[model samples]
Target: MTKGYIHIYTGDGKGKTTAAIGLAIRAVGAGKKVCILQFMKSLAYSEQKILQSIPGITLITLGKPYFIAKEGMLTDEQRKTWGNHIRIYPAGHPPKDYREMTLKGIEQAIDAVSKNYDMVILDEYNMARWYDLATEEETEKILKARRPEVELIFTGRNAPKEILDAADLITEMKKIRHYYDKGVPVRTGIEN
Candidate 1:
């Protein structure tokens, strides 16, 4: 029996990528091929290290380390905090080589689907579209072109309406409350 493709995970809360990663792990454990294209994120986290060790699973990172803040609208403190969070690329700038990397990652994911991978996870992809790094039409084309037998998971907040309408399954993580509102910072191994 062929598995249906297309899942969208979105909302103002968290756990989207975490859920997708869990699915990827399960797919790899079942001896099925799995691939994760991590968009708008750098490869510096512990999850990346752990997931890369899994057999029959591929991980591709397409973003340089940088905070995705609103342009020209950050306070000094916010700027400082974001500066700490941003990953400094080898070229000392983000968006320098990110476009090519993202495009390549997309192509690689498509190729993996064509090669009969059981699942593909596109992590933080919604943020890419939200930030205007990738267009909604382009994402739609990619999803529409996916092979029937390959399942796909998209993780991120604020997913586009078109994507939600096209998805077979959609999970929204609404943020009722968050510790960040109380001035809590992200913890390593837990938040990272």
Candidate 2:
């Protein structure tokens, strides 16, 4: 029997989701079943196409068509890049649709673990906890539900202390250098 570990990819940097996707690809290549649930994002990136075409990988995104941004805070580049899906708001409240989507995603996490998937990746789930869309306690409950053989992964920035404490492995992608800070737009296949 295989022993699965709980891992977290987090921090104020890039590549958290990318790292999870890499892990998913590795898992699939090794003949393991994988379930990838993306939270708070709806952009159709190039990888989505590849992941969909790949066998043994199930990918689902729980988010509105629009992206969330703090009102009056979007840079010119941000507005230009995400012009189609900008949901700028004055308050701190996340959109109701995103909340609903995330709640459903949480349920799906429980279901995925119960079904004995080899690996379950909850991408950007820490954002849900950060925005109060889901509580740390709720996330903890899902972690508890995972079977001993179910590999669980959480990815995002601003992960709660409780979540970090619960993880068997945690990798923080610290942003020491980033081109995004240099006014370069997101590359088509690299950062999109």
Q: Write down the TM-score of every candidate.
A: 0.87, 0.88
lDDT (Cα, tens digit) per residue for candidate 2, span 1-192: 789998999998999989999999999999999999888767477778888889999998787767777566788886998887687765557677777778898999989987869999988889878766787767877888888899999999988888888899999999999987898988878987
lDDT of 1 by residue, 57-99 (tens): 8888887766655455567777787777643333222354566
Clashes, model 1: 1
User: lDDT winner among the candidates?
Assistant: 2
Q: Deviation in angstroms for 176 in model 2?
A: 1.3
Error of 1 at 80 (Å): 3.5
Candidate 1 segments whose C-alpha is farther than 4 A from its true place: 72-76, 84-96
